[model samples]
Target: MLDANLKKQLDTYLQNIVSPIELSVSGDNSPKSKELLELATEISGLSGNISLREAAAGRTPSMSVAPAGQAPRVSFAGIPMGHEFTSLVLALLQAGGHPSKASPELQEQIRNLEGQFHFETYISLSCQNCPDVVQALNLMATLNPNISHVMIDGALFQEEVNQRQVMAVPAVYLNGEHFGQGRMSLEEIVGKLDTGAAARKAAALDDKAPYDVLIVGGGPAGAAAAIYAARKGIRTGLVAERFGGQVMDTVGIENFISVPYTEGPKLAASLEQHVKEYGVDIITDQRAAGIRRGELIEVPLASGAALKSKAVILATGARWRELKVPGEAEYRTKGVAYCPHCDGPFFKGKRVAVVGGGNSGIEAAIDLAGIVEHVTVLEFADSLRADEVLQRKANSMGNIDIIMSAQTTEVLGDGSKVVGMQYTDRVSGESKRLEVAGIFVQIGLVPNTEFLQGSEVELTRFGEVVIDNRGATSMAGVFAAGDATTVPYKQIIISMGAGATAALGAFDHLIRAGS
Candidate 1:
């Protein structure tokens, strides 16, 4: 049932619809289906222009919204609950002749696009990042008949999800081929589509003449390195599966030195822009599979292409460590989540739990407490590991509850979504169950250095690349930085400084070799 306050807000948003929209719901008469239907009916009742109807049996719960005369080109298959609720609302507004949120340049590109293109975006209902991508694709579909898009609920279609090997939400497939994953900007989406439509593949680089510097990864560290190397008038090349790395998944970042406050995507965009200002060859959508050291270092790509470089800088960042408990994997997008910033909105007005009592966990709890009904933080340690200031702030929040010595045993779900979780008290040896709509895991991070296996790169036991003060690795002409390295701190400012140091070290190596 919709809360009165939420219903009122939805009513206000719907009242401004300038055109009529049709919402078609479909599914068996199961409890989930009925719940979705009831919500749809209530939404439809709020506005006179909006109407609802049931689709044929076996079809998933989908909404096909279109203006009075136009046929629906955008369809969403899922309950559109959680953070996805905003996606539904935006879709309806677009169908009702509202202006698109995409940039004018993007809209022009979409209109100019030719040939048939099908975009299938897999999303978890709770993922906040998924909506922007889905909405952008949907807007493209609405603008051009040749382009079409559909949103697939990863949790509802387990078989399809497994077939695609979807590891995370916001996984976009272009023309049945996996395009990319995570929070992608409109430019990235359009660029991928352009490449996919042309059937372009990575080409092997000529070993005879290698780049002056080749950077692995495309986070703040790699981007900074590229810019610095390019400033030295060298042939700089950067290879990355995605430009922003883990920063794209992050939200508010206040401690970035000069920048008093900024969001992750905003900072990432600035980094990419700064790198582009130089002569760095930014190669996106490519993963470094392995490295071979010789006179010229060779980095092999997962796409079967190899790039050779005189010097290499490894800045492959880290990913959030997962809790390997039961139901954690099965209900990853359903209820269990890693990024509170990305999925917190979906749990609005609902009780949620956060596993961990570190600074990140406490920050997540405080951030979620503003939107969610209540936030319960469970920590395995005897006391909170967060800073005293952060702990005090979290404690002051009435909606936030901190539980110490609580070890998460399992995530409990109803085969569709997360319903609650079980934990054991470390001190008391007592088991307890907490009914929660979602669980945000804020464990530490694991470095992404598996590609360095069998390579000459030195690494710590935790898999982080070993580096010196100058960011120089054990191997000559090779460097490492960012969270993947043995840096004392894993902050953005520190990574950028490390990257600059590595670039300077590489430049010095090149100068000495030339001398």
Candidate 2:
């Protein structure tokens, strides 16, 4: 269907448009700027050719041509950096080729409510967790381009945000209304999206993750936070690196007030289940890496996607501290690991050592005794530090051996694989070496807060973010909760309370800013 001249021009455009050389010139020119310039000239020539072709066909000169076989898909609104790049390019290509019909029945419905939305998100450039918020929004927009998304940097958009009454990065505005502040689930958007009453005029939009609030984390604190936040009538979203936080590595949670005998993971699961009843957005395996702070928050993911949000709650729990022993890092996946539940099954019939004499070490050793051929528990303390019950259980396990007053001096490996370990006796000053197939180090955990550098916040001596009774950090428009902060007596129940407090503080910040 293409005329000879038009086809030649189209092919030429495609060929030159994708070159790195064309992306930039060596001097002061920028890649994107030059790329756009080159594209404009090509488009102009292409447009002129199309016009002439239409005129010859007896159609009006202003009429658009069908390129090869398709209609052009045009961008109706904003497309900045991050995941929007692909969407924008695709839209332009489709616009040049063919228009696509709405893929879902909800298309028309979204169009009706399109005029009612005004969304803005704010985020910090340095924050790792901010990227998830970016992807969620981009996905929503791609699902229906009628939904407009505006991104603003939280640091730079401070003045505009204060005018809008925003107290944090990652804020959303719906129909000129403040939707909420913090990390949101698709469900939250769905709830705010008007698909009812007006459905008689437009088709019904299919149900998706329409959330009121989304709490990210599955630790005791995350669960507790969700219980409180969701009870307040908001759809919550929860994304955890794992189901539980540091406590999940714990054998038991003794000081959790009333829960006399509860394990970490089970408790986490219970909380997760409870939050699900309230329709919280629970996403596991989704990690936030980079944040774009502004009126709208954009979070880039480890998977190269992004999520956007109005406000965000970080319940990303911390990881246990490693001894950083020699060979530890080198042999990580080959024969050393942290979580026994995840890697224990692979070590079946293999000899392994669990480092540490604390409750965690003993607990891990006992668990591994059932799976691995042999379990060696190493302790640097004079005697076992774990509770009497755990010690008793470790003693009863025939294949489990406890070596007290010993520390791992070196982790030995064969470059490509872990082979053994070197140990020193604290009392006798004697050294011993043991060959093992696997090593599971369980000392304790470090707060997963390394990503908050350069942000307006205070960190404890231990590097945890310091916060007050209300989960208010030293900075304005910013607050932190969960294991990453400096709330002592790190318990699941306590963290949950802390998360709830933080969310409330965020709510207060939003109310004050909005009012």
Candidate 3:
């Protein structure tokens, strides 16, 4: 199933296996089963330490990886190809007793888990976010014998996907019940299962000494700021709910300068690695609750812990703008999705609607036209705001229909899943309903400044933090940058530049204030 180059690389990775391992194959005479067996055989052939055996499991066309004679803890219910191929490789190494890159504390936390955990994650092959969840669970299963995880391909297992009403990728289930439905770090997953870990960690954070510069986000802007501050020979720290921010949901990023092409997750990983090279104290899985202005600026976390710093840089970034119509939140995962690249595959051969006319919406329509039966683009404006090149490409597609001056009013669902969408004709003042199985909202972004509401910091009417040319905010000793600030552009490169400027501005403030 793998090409020659892929086999060569797998061979190189398999050399890292220090202990004996086994591949337990469960399959039938079906084509998928045969394909799986072929892939398993190819993997087993790479190293002498690896062996294979047929086994009976509840799910067919599955393979389990573990040490010889041990009950396999890491299993794949479907072919782990595409984005999950890396997951397959990692599972092999971890199951073969190779040490993981996870922190020693986190590994111990997994080992101390008390109960048996059977995690099943539904994923699509094209999803960039699914691998993180899958790989994390797989590592947990490897670290703790009581934990077992199975990665299930949603597209290949349509029956289960429909039964679970899984309209989104990276949907996780624990012990046959819903656990989560998005990108989650290993720390976040373990904190959920361990229950008391959050409070303990929060208390530890509360006791930390004040930093010279504290960054309140982990996107590109926050990363750049952390690097700059750390390089300035000062105490730098960064806190974030997630490191990647909105970039994690992004798919193709061809416009980033210096690099010809890259994906969101890859760039986010590089940014994180670069920040780690500095002396910055990186804190994850923590959301900023509010900021308090004082002699030393304070940023409180949602977990009840507050961090203090001489200066603070707010780069909380932004999130996808939602359609605030009725039934939209009720059926968010049921049928309404915000990412076309992540959730588009779930609506194969079904009709879907794109609720915007910008570049993102038109691009989504063009991408979905190949998979879905039909795509209707709804534009509240009279003309599309997409680039002329994109408009031309979308117009050339037969399955795409552009609806001008159509305002989305409501999402229609049958309690279980989406059945259609309701919109209003702005010009004719007529209400219209279109039968679509899914609604992909491609509207612009809203700054993630809700946490800053009621704070002393001045903000624009749109909730963006008002900033000067030096990136300093109205609040003394506090600066802002990136999407959270009133920046004219929201591109990645622009965010990075703003981050550097904010860091420098904070440093200047610290020097002048006699910090």
Candidate 4:
């Protein structure tokens, strides 16, 4: 099933395998089964250490990758192609005893887990966030014999998805119970499974010495600031709940300078790698709760640990703006999704509504028109705010309908999932209802400045941190940048520049303070 170029690449990757492994597949005479067998056969043909065998599993058309003649730990219930293809390669390498790049501490944590964990993840091939969760669980399975995992393609196994009422991609189940949905990092997963891990980590963090510059986010802004600060030859540290922030949820990134094209997760990985090269102390899976100003600026984490720094750069970034209407929160992931790129596949052949008229909203409508049966766009303004080209493209699509002066009132659901949406017509003063299985919200973003509400830092009415040209906030010694600040434009390149400015501003403050 793999092309010649793919076979060459696969062969090169398989050379890293140090031990024997088996691809035991369970399939029947069906076309999908044949496809699975063909894929396994092609993979086995590349390396002498790899072998193939026919086996029985609860789910047909499944393939298990494991050590030779041993119980399988990592399995796939459907073809692991598209975004998950990398996951399959990693599974093969890890199963064959190739060393994993996970930190030594994290590997040890996985090996020490006491209880059995059978994880089943349902995902769509088009989802940009599914690979992270799949690879994370697969890593756990490969590390601990007590843990096992299976990645199931939601589109290929519609019956199972319906039975579980899984309306979102990357839905994970632990021991047959709903564990989580959406993008999850390996560290987050381990933290959830190991209850005492957080407290121990917090205690360790509390003992660390003060930093010259501390960055409180891990997006492009935080990464750039960390690199700039570390290069100044002073102590630098960065804390992030997740390294990528909103960028991780982004899809195509064609506008980033120097690089013509890239994806969100790929760019995020590169950013992390670049930051690592600078020897900055990086902390993940920790959310900043609040900041306290003293002789040294202190940032408190939700884990009860406080980090002190001579200068603090706030680049906490932004998140998707919610509808906040009744039933919207309850029906989230039950048919109300924020990311059209990730959740659009699940709404194939169904009607859906896009709740905005800007670039993001119209773009979502255009993208959904290809897969969904019909797309209804509800714009609160009298006219569309999207670019003329986008408006023209959306208008050209036959399956798309645009409504003007629409004010979304409430999301209507059948107590289980979304069945429709209610909106008010500002022009006619009429209430209208549209039957849609899914509601994709693409309104805008809300700055991640809620934690600074009670603090002395000045904020705009919209909660954005007020900053000067040097990226210094209202409070002395505390700088702000990126989407969380009062930057005029919220773009990746702009954030990077803002980050550098903030780092320089912090350095100047430190020099003056020490003098």
How many Å off is the CA of 447 in candidate 3? Answer: 0.5
lDDT of 2: 0.58
TM-score of each: 0.71, 0.52, 0.98, 0.98
- Root-mean-square deviation per candidate: 8.4, 20.7, 1.1, 1.1
What lDDT tens digits, residue by residue, belong to model 1 across residues 26-130? 767677778778888998989999988776633476666666666667777767777677778887887877888556856877788778888889887656578
Model 1 superposed RMSD (Cα): 8.4
Regions of candidate 2 where Cα sits further than 4 Å from its true position:
1-218, 233-270, 277-285, 290-293, 296-311, 345-350, 371-374, 396-399, 427-430
Q: Can you give the lDDT of residue 488 in candidate 2?
A: 72
Q: What's the CA error at residue 230 for candidate 4, in Å?
A: 0.8
Span of 10 residues, lowest total lDDT, candidate 3: 243-252
Better of 1 and 4 by TM-score: 4
lDDT of 3 by residue, 297-357 (tens): 8999999999999999999999989999999999998999988877989999999999999
Ranking by lDDT: 4, 3, 1, 2
In TM-score terms, candidate 1 sits at: 0.71
- Among all windows of ten consecutive residues in candidate 4, which has the lowest summed lDDT? 506-515
Candidate 1 ranges beyond 4 A from true positions: 1-128, 135-144, 149-181, 184-199, 204-209
lDDT tens digits, residue span 41-101, model 4: 9999999999999999999889999989789999999999988999999999999999999
User: Model 1 lDDT vs. the true structure?
Assistant: 0.83
